[model samples]
Target: MPSISRSTPMRCAATSKRPGCRRSACRAPRRTGSITCGGRTSAANCPTTAARCSPGGAALGEAPDVVFVVADGLSAFAAAKQALPLLSAVRPKLEGWRIGPVVVARQARVALGDEIGELLGARLVAMLIGERPGLSSPDSLGVYLTYAPKVGCHDAQRNCVSNVRPEGLPYDAAAHKLHYLLTHARRLGLTGVGLKDDSDALLPAARTEAERLAAE
Candidate 1:
């Protein structure tokens, strides 16, 4: 895991068209334990070993409503290809919410978002990470949403949207689900197993179909 200290320069674009949005990149240190990377000992040897941050600038006294972290988990290809498109799809749905910078991390884990969110003083954190590669899907992305993010948060405390790829879950569908989760999590003040994903039921087509079935 990469250590974040106050001394670490967290810089963002001062002239960015999007208010509060800044981009920063960081490199994770090499680990001591033996790890397999293309049969090499160090996982750092992998092509994608740096983490990046693109934060939405916040007012001096105010924290952003949410922070977005894009990590290259097991597949950097997934992050490189899908992160921006997914963000573009979701941003429209998040109108009026304070979104912190977007962080792109190399050799990152999902939990890294917690630390980043804490550092930014955000109300919630969303981590979009690359899933472990599969024989058929080498570039699948996954999304994890955590409320009141902090270090030591258990997996049970987060909600996940997985297999986010063109061949898997379409960006629009994934964004819709994410918007629903973010809105409800803020309102209900929780995530993880406690917050179920029932967004499918709220879709106009789904609802209309269900009503038609009921009328029959």
Candidate 2:
């Protein structure tokens, strides 16, 4: 439901990708900062209290290639781990960008996207987050890229990729989707405004990478 005035981005109703556990597993999630866990409503629901968005939502850095934040799972622990786990791995690729803290609530993620775009002075903001946990795709991940920063902008103004766990979109594929979204977002100067397609490129790259890793 990440849409202000645009098409509603799909928010799959699923929860917890913490291996083969009951749907209720990973429930009662905990969070850091003033954010909330367990439900959609959180401390960030208010605009003022929301964590500072933007690549360097708090700092002004060089025009970054792109600004991104990932919310792994709704649980506070999930979000924290998402940011810290790959700190060393993702740091270099994000050289021109400052990785912001992971945020929950698709709406907040959308807000962060706008904040990043406004702060970076870039055309788009990509917020990669864990999708809502559901029976259809509990472990899936989502990526939301917006053209501009404003409240209630709508979903059509953004682009998204979902079902990002093994049985769904793989990490490599998700990365590729991210790569194309960034490139396309730069080219189109808008995500969801007109005709655009990047799914083919994303799946191939992801599959190839997965196969390559398997060979090793």
Candidate 3:
């Protein structure tokens, strides 16, 4: 695993990627791990299939072209009520998206990548999750973006947006950035280690603003 002391790239983009990996490289299932999100445990790790962390089955209706892994805390539901508005503005572009139930997991960040990708046939995935609680902040939300979805995708092809509490990366801002990166990754045909960050082009103004705000 790489250290967290590295300086990376792009304003809206994030992750450690492995472009060399093929889908066949990892055929393992997500290890049995546990996590607590949105006051519930991960469905993937559920003792029974009926208790799945995600919403499924034909009765729930057709799966959208996209799957959203929402890691929730007890308060994530409320935070998401505020956060969804931020994502809602971009819904038109992500026309086939289906925001599902919040899933708790032992390692939710990566679990979301595999879960979202397989269900949606997506080449790339973005997880809007609840960060682990800290002394100073517990309500904070985050986004982890990645390429090439699969189980055991540790440190492989991705980035994250942290501190989405009232003072951190706000919902509207984060949503814009997420969409921008996803589009660029798709258009460039880049993912994993090969994914170039084109987010700088889409939101130079925002990056500058983010920097300016952080510096303040």
Specify the highest-TM-score model's number.
Answer: 1
* Candidate 2's TM-score: 0.55
Using all chains and alpha carbons, the TM-scores for the candidates as numbered come to 0.69, 0.55, 0.55
User: Can you write out model 3's per-residue Cα lDDT over 1-216, one digit (the tens) per residue?
Assistant: 111110111111112245753323322223222222221233335523212234232122343333345444334543443334444544556644443322223233345445445444556656666666676666676666666565555554666666654345555566676777666666665555566556646766766666665556
Stronger candidate by TM-score (1 vs 3): 1
- Which residue runs of candidate 1 sit more than 4 Å off their true CA positions? 1-61, 204-216
lDDT string, candidate 2, 1-216, tens digits: 231111111111123446774534223333222322222343346543343332321334354445454554343333333322222333444444433433333334445556544654555566656667665545555667776555455777877765555556555555566666666666666777563765675467666755565454
Would you give me the overall lDDT of model 3? 0.46
Stretches of model 3 off by over 4 angstroms after superposition: 1-65, 73-82, 95-109, 135-137
**Candidate 1: what lDDT?**
0.67
On TM-score, who's better, 1 or 2? 1
RMSD of each: 10.1, 10.3, 14.1
Tens digits of lDDT, candidate 1, 124-162: 999888899998879888999999987778899999988
Cα error, candidate 2, residue 76 (Å) = 5.4
